[model samples]
Target: MVFRRLLGSMGVGGPQVDTVLAGGAVVPGGTLSGQVCLLGGESAERIEHIGLELLARVEAEHDDGESEGAVVFERFTVGGGFVLGPHEERAVPFSVPVPWETPVTELYGQPLGIVLGVRTELAVAGARDKGDLDPLVVRPLPVQEAVLEALGQLGCGFRSADLEYGHIGGTGQTLPFYQEIELTPAPQYAHAVSEFELTFIASPAGCQVVVEADRRGGLFSSGHDELSRVSLGHADAHTLDWNAEVDGWLRRLTDRPAHQPSLGHQAAPYACAPPVHHDPYGHGAHGHQDPYGHQGHHVDHGHHVGHGHHGHHDPYDRHDGHGSHGSYDSYDPYDKDDDHRSGPGVGTAIAAGAAGLAVGFVGGMVADEIVDEIGDFFDGDDD
Candidate 1:
């Protein structure tokens, strides 16, 4: 949605700025384009820069508990260094590359409840103001789709997905948070495993597919989590034997020894177990952040999954907690949602229109309250 507002800090008659995203659900590693419209105020103003920031609502875990916040993951200065004539209007168009590992917000033409956004920042005459925020929708890559389709074909059910704050320890994870896609076990594997999580850390080279399974221990032992890693290339979207490949991973997880002790084991192969909680910290499902588990907080690397020499340590460093939505019915693998969805960017662009934006819209978070309050403060309509 387009957020048009006067640089409130600029005072009466300051410049007006509105940012509109080009419509379309973008895939990871793709491009997001939009236009930032600027109108001169009472007088000509020296504009310094116009920038866009990509933000996502992520959940975090720590000693105290969990809360939520808008995490800025990417930033780009689209246009800048121009002069605004008094009462003149200008539109600065831009296209920026999205991170290769950005989270998938929707699947099967339904919202997975993941919240992402693009906020605009304008710098005028040495003063900068955050103009507005537009909701961002991301679709999976072709390879990601192939892998997920294989799971669906295997009877794996889709649950919930979320972004977790903190590192995954060993992987080449560039973002401060990683996306975790949770799934229910198929009947065949149900006896051996409870559930599993899929994390795809994609890059220009390929995607690092991390399959974490919550295994059901035998009568003699308690259940544990198993982790398996595989490399998937973009080219494999059409070439690889995904079903067979995934089946192989499942076999490995079920046949291997997965759990480690609960103390001091945080390293390479990763602790296959879920931090073991979707809402383990009692934080809301969306944008849940443990206030104590922030950027500076120390993440406890222990959980009830994985195995090791110490028998007290949890492997797979960096706490990654994910939530899930039990299974549902009526799914069409060959659904035409993609064809019917707005062409490439049209849907997303349409969302950028000024109408869809209002109080309690994007992510249904406090950010909306903040934005609406700003608008009302300037419009002088406090009712």
Candidate 2:
């Protein structure tokens, strides 16, 4: 998307700014290059500086329920400290490093309903405006892709993915929020668990993969959640069979007690959100909490039927904060048409799981407040 907003703060003859991200998808811990194009208004103007901000549509958990908002996670100053001639056009090329913990917005070149954006900030004559808001397409790092592919092979179909605003207690987690990819259990494990959630915390060395499952209680026991952690070298993703490794981890995790659940859903008390800490790199010395910190709770949307199809409705939450009880960002349960998008299926896979249970989402279109946020964003908001 190209934004050419008249510097409203600059008045009628003020210059206009447009930010253009190089065409293509970016990955976590990767560099995003683009141009900040400025067009001189009626006359020459003093340009203080040009800045770029990386923003994510993040979901937060509160006492009552959940809310989604646009959060600026990273910022960079690309150019400025100069003057522009009347009607002169200048393009400032820039390259910025994306945060290592940035959430993935797409899979195999498809939208995951997680929206990220690059907003351009222009400063002139003591006035600043966050101009263009271009949709940021974050593809998974190679390792992340490999892991998900492995899960696909394991018969775990995609359920949903979202960003949470909190910390996982027992890990090298530095970010204030995290991403969770929820999946339906494969047939073999269906009897033991309902679904599982995966999180990836990446650093220069590698990433920490955290897995949690909702284990159905035995005839006499109520359902509970199991948590496990696996560290994989960036290179290990391509070198090993993640299916077997992941399976082994799950088997071992079953022996541990499950995370405490909330009143309505199974909460991953193991990955609770704590105080907020931002990490663009440079890991500070941090303490580990027992995978016992209850980050936040998952919010659920009731039974949903979409696109002429219906399935069991499963509502979940993803909040990310430091463990004042946080969770992952949310996946819009009412997105009726998301399943029709190209690339990987975010909903049910063609192949059924054990007992012919279909995996993935049933699909739906977004509505209500979600529709407003998205529409205003693309339509251009002065804010």
Candidate 3:
């Protein structure tokens, strides 16, 4: 999609600018190529420069409350010091590299609601005008996709995705905010946790997978949050059993002694878990089982599952908080575990199937909205 907006800095009879992004979502650190079209106004004017700005609608949290604003994270000067003849039209094409820390906007082709855009600004004579604004769609890297795909196979469904306004302590976090992909717990593990939230931080070396489980609480025991971090290289993803690996991650996180409290702190063990079972066919069944709970204000990280000692306090065993514990037709093939952790079964299978169906359509919707908005604002005449 493309956006073309007249330059506000110049009254009528000034030049206009329009920008169009290439089709489909680009990956982080990938090149975004597009064209900027300019139409000369009443008479030929000296065009000083043409610039492109990368914009994002980010959430900001403060002591008092929360607010959202459009922020410019990157800028590129594409065409400048040129001349435009009266009634003349020119097209300037550019290929720019996106920042590695760029937040992903889609997965399995689904919209994650992380809005991004490109704005075109033209400087004519001494006046500067903001011309266009369009949406930007970004897909996850290969490794990132593999991990999410694995989770889907494990029976986790896509919950709402959003960007948080705080830095994750004890990690190589470059952005001020991070994106969280929330998921419904698999059936077996449903009794252990209400839900799980996953975050991925990818770099040249490897990607970090952060899992946070909201365990269910029983009487006399308060619920606590468990966090686990793991790192995986591009080569290791295919060989690893993502189901077993993710299950192990949950176990280690939940098993932590409640007495050792680390608020806002992520625990260690930055290694990928080994693969569960190798499938001869490419369609591997690995995902979460439990159905999703009711939608709440935020991904409730406060659900109590089982009890543990934070210090001297003891927590109790619990059920998955996703409404009635009535059993559904098993979707995946995995067996259930005490803490809701299950083997490869119907629960995991169903999650992977649902996410696959939903991601493509959602992703395209978001991509079209973003690109079209940008084109409308940036791609047009400047009179």
**Per-candidate TM-score against the hidden true structure:** 0.69, 0.72, 0.68
lDDT of 3 by residue, 1-383 (tens): 23353546787887777888888777764567899988878878888878777766666665578765555556667788888887688889987656545788765455666767787878888888887766788877655666676677766667766666445544565444567777777675676678888887754445677787776665645455666667665444445566676666766655544433335433322221111221111111112222121112112122223322132211111123211112121221112232222223434443454355345424534445655644543344231
lDDT of 2 by residue, 1-383 (tens): 24475656778778888888898877676678889888888889999978877777667876779876665666677889999889888899997666668888666644566767777888888998777667777877656766776677777877777888666655556555688878888787777778888898875556677787777776556776666666665555445666686666655655444434445654445443433333332222222322212232111111111122112211111222211111211211112342222335433241222112211231333323333455465445343
Residue 139, model 1: lDDT of: 76
- lDDT to native, each model: 0.61, 0.61, 0.58
lDDT tens string, model 1, 33-114? Answer: 7888888889888889787767777777655797555666766677789889987889898866666678987654445656
Alpha-carbon runs more than 4 Å astray in model 2: 1-3, 254-383
Residue 20 of model 2, lDDT score: 82
Candidates 1 and 2, the one with greater TM-score: 2
